[model samples]
Target: MASFPPNRATTLKAAFRACDVGPLVGADIERYYVDLSNVRNTEAIESLNTRLDFLEPAEFCSILFTGHRGCGKSTELRKIQKRWEVEYKVIYIEADAEIDILDAEYTDLYLVIIKKVADELNKLNLKFDAQLLHNFETWFKEITQETEQTVERSVSISASAEAGGQIPFISKLLGKIQAQIKGADKQKQTIRQLLQKDIGRLQADINLLLGDAFVKLKQKYPEYEKGFLIIFDNLDRVPPNVANHLFFDYSEQLQSLHCTIVLTAPISVVYSEKNLSNAFDTPNIVPMVNIYKLERQRGDLEYNDVGIKAVASLIEQRVDIDAVFESPQDLLELVKASGGHVRQLMRITAKAFLTAATRKHNKVTTDDVTYAIKQEQFNFERSIPTELYSELAKVCLTKDVPKDENGWLMLFSLWVFEYNGKTRWNYINPTVRQSDAFQEALQSITANP
Candidate 1:
């Protein structure tokens, strides 16, 4: 744990820094990670750990890990990587960072996996079978028109010294191709037209290289008995059409790769009518931490003490809450307004801190919280469609999220909260429900229902 300076100004600055509205990775994650395995059904991570821990090195398995953006899926995945580092050569890739994620195909994913695995293996002085490399190089050159001279110039101009050594000519060419596809729409169309016909040949050659690399890796690091674990993060951000093409249209190819893999998928796909389980098995979902106590029989909701503590612990890990807030009630109000979305809590807290400082308050107060929440409410009102108000009202009253596009939209937008008690249910975001339009809509529905 990191300690803060005792000065009041320094403490407030630390509080705001701790409330950053972005994903935490590496050391920052290890320092501040909260175990929510007991809070919701986080068995997804547990099951994945067991599978990798117990499965044979030669065996291949794929799991779909999903959750709304900022629900801490990446944090939990980092935890998984840390736990399995001793046994598996974990290669974590953010798909969006590597490819044109919006137009990505299974074939593109295949290239990334093979390149990354080969690159890692090269670090061990483990070389690929010469014939396999030759075939892939020849095929890629014939298709992409990449020559030795062009490859050298591209590599020299594009790569740093460390990355330069890891990337082979084939991998360097593919990297240039992916960058072109992402930046030039016209070039993407031309490149796809040229290589789509050789997709099968491309896949076969890459798989062979992977097999050779896997064998060499085991020969070098005998203790790394479990082979490779490739995690594809941020595939969840792709548009629905692209997701369908990669996860549905080419499901067989995605799973056929010979390694234990975890792919982050979009949350909406979990609710779609498509039978994803029949192909890749049921996806593991990271639901929101249950911050509210539900009296199901009476339909009453209140802040749960266990959940409040967990959310507060997130802040307390980095900042002393008592030192930053005028009273405990102000902190509680901010937590209640967050509705258990991790990023939302950070944003709201940061806003409240700014609100207090702008007004010269010694510490954050309830008035600062109220003003901050109102600002958030206005932002939501601007984005949410007027007609969806009625559907949101129904969810608040019935506590059931309709199994359709509207429901998925609400969940995606963070306008609703999903919980698993005896079964899955949803409720309106407390802040959204406080909007004047939402209040009127709820009254109308209550009168009619």
Candidate 2:
């Protein structure tokens, strides 16, 4: 049998050869291929499809699509948007890109929406009022003191001069510009109030402009059934404070629009704040598609087998797996350790493949998979704060559940424990709960409270 020397290079080469026996793909594997044959959670997809179907008949339906990070939420959103575009005039925007909305300001929020709407118009080669563009220029100057005029700055020019006063490009450009500005400083605070007034005026102007356009379009194409649908994806990426304002404070205005609005947000955003629940109380307003419930079993061979097959299918589209792995089982081991996180699975696979390729191994084996996992764990540790683990340890040791709602929610959301064959919010690990420090902390908190 071939053996490795005690040296690091020799050991690495041996591991690489082992990995080649049945190479594992890492989390860094390309997502496009993995996501191509996306196994749609039938229930989640059906609910969303039902909403889209309803919206197609000139009805408004708002949905809050919630899932953990890397759980394919964005991919599903894109799929829905693409499918609805033929029937409904779809405009998709990312809320995280709107920086100014975090301060609980409705004006900045409106600006972002308007700007996104204008961008859609521009893409469709539509035109709108020159006067509105000029108004936007003046409003832009008043809000943002920048004097330089670029394609972005001349939104009014694009909206009015390029066509008739029918396109709302200026409004959309203003939203983009407003979203770029950060925090409610004294200067921005003053500008914000002024901008709010302009926003009201701008909204009125847009309602008239868009209303006229809708009428004209309907007159021209009597067969067109739906009005428009604007999807705001990645609202969860926004600061929670800002997200609350966008979803809660201005919900009515959003609903009242002649178009349908769909928002994708973290599940926590809806449940974390009482105000959020109160503001968005309409049961039909935001139908939720819980994607978190679809998590696959960790360390299950059958589960890993399916995931590996998915991963292999993805990798095969970009590179030759036969040249990478001796057999499929090599890849299966890596998938088993990945916990079904697509990104993590890809990353592990990629690293293992790279390691094997460097060592000129014909097939990856178990040893290489182990090495790749170690490498991934090392890289992951570097990105995460060292203190976070200590905090987690403290929580685990104390068995002291947090009193604050946010803190408790954070613990659950962060996946601090696994219980009853599913991830839940209880500290059931005996070893962790048995820690003296944990017990003491729990006593102290109980006594203090």
Candidate 3:
């Protein structure tokens, strides 16, 4: 909850800052989190919590957590991490931060995981069996043709404190390999090819290290009864080809790692023609909060009060909405138009706040809100293909997203949003549907029918 400031300008500035679209982390999570599980009609947090809380540490389960880019998936993942970290050593890796996302391979992630595990265990003063480390080190060196001398020579010029002379051999080797993969250099493909040849050996070596680490952790901290939980975030940000490569071509590789892992994938993966469940369980989708009703009557879609309140709560938790907006109803108007996409709401709110401040309005007016949404709608419009308009019309009319590439495209582009009622469904984005072209397409389809 937020307290009112005496000056309207102070409130406006606070509103603008509160509307940042980035994921909330650390203390900010306490201040700004809104539980939308009931509104979205999916138990996203509980599903992961139940699995991790109940499963035996040796079970080695993997769950696919998915949603649109800004529907608060990362925030939810952080929540999951917070809940499970007490029992599991959570290694939260941002794929884009650690890998060349577009060009990443499964082996790239393998190296990243190994690097992180070895580094963490080193920090904890836990040592792997010397022979075990020596065997893997010798094999790794033979394949990549790197030894202590060469690694020391290469990284000496620009040495980081973490990968400095004092660290173990595995950490130094992994540091060099991770930099190569992320750097997109000639050696990237060479290393990947070497590891790809013996995928099982790579997985086996890593799992052994993980097992050793798990044993040490259990012995050291009784709280760590359960083993490691790797929260692999931002894998969803990879391009479709990379996603296909990581999740499809090497689905088994992603699953074979020995840990209770939570991985994020693009929404497209849920609708992909491939039966992903055979490889991993059905993806746990973080559907949009139910803004519009499941069915429209008399060609009018009704807003769900529960959904509106949840979306508004997301903003109110950060900003004193009544103080910033001209009226509570005006804030409602912004929420309805936001379509329950958290980032989109923030974007609209921030712009409207800036617009009102520029005009010196005491509060954000409906005109400012409208201007912000229209600007967002136009940006979305530019990305959409002309031919997709009719298809979007069909989705709007049917209240169902087609199970195909077009459906995936519409979702990926944010031209449509998924929801859950008695069953899963989709609807056009409110701003997109408000566009003249969409309205005309809707009319044309109705007239033809």
Best by TM-score: 3
The predicted structure with the larger TM-score, 1 or 2, is: 1
Candidate 1 stretches greater than 4 Å from native: 1-10, 156-158, 162-166, 295-300
Model 2 TM-score relative to the real fold: 0.63
Model 2 segments more than 4 A misplaced: 1-41, 56-58, 96-106, 129-176, 179-190, 197-203, 220-224, 241-256, 270-278, 281-320, 358-368, 379-449
Q: After superposing candidate 3 on the true structure, give the runs of residues whose Cα lies further than 4 Å from its correct spot.
A: 1-10, 153-159, 162-165, 296-300
Q: Give per-residue CA lDDT, model 3, range 1-449, as digits (tens).
A: 23322322247777787777888887777766877777886676677778787887667888889888798889988888888888888889998888898788888888888888887887777888787788889989998889789887666544556445557789789878888877757778878888989978888988888888888888887687887888989988876656766788888888888887788988877777786777788778888888776664323488989889989888778777767887888789889988998888888888899898888998899898888889888988888888888899988888777877788778877899888757887789988998888888889999996
Candidate 3 clash pair list: none
Model 2 gets an lDDT of 0.51
TM-score per candidate, chains pooled: 0.91, 0.63, 0.92
RMSD of 1: 2.9
Error of 1 at 340 (Å): 1.5
Q: lDDT by residue for model 2 over 41-150, one digit each (tens)?
A: 33455577786786545456566665444445565666677677677677777665665434545555456665666666565565555665565566566556644444
Ranking by lDDT: 3, 1, 2
Q: Is candidate 2 or candidate 3 better by lDDT?
A: 3
Question: How badly does each model clash, as a count of residue pairs?
Answer: 0, 44, 0
What would the per-residue lDDT of candidate 1 be over residues 227-324, giving only the tens digit for each residue?
A: 88999998888766676677788888888877888999877666667767877887787777778877654334878988887877777676677888
Our model 2 lands, by Cα RMSD against the true structure, at 9.7
The models' CA-based lDDT, in order, is 0.78, 0.51, 0.81
Please rank every candidate by TM-score, starting with the best.
3, 1, 2
**Total residue pair clashes for candidate 3:** 0
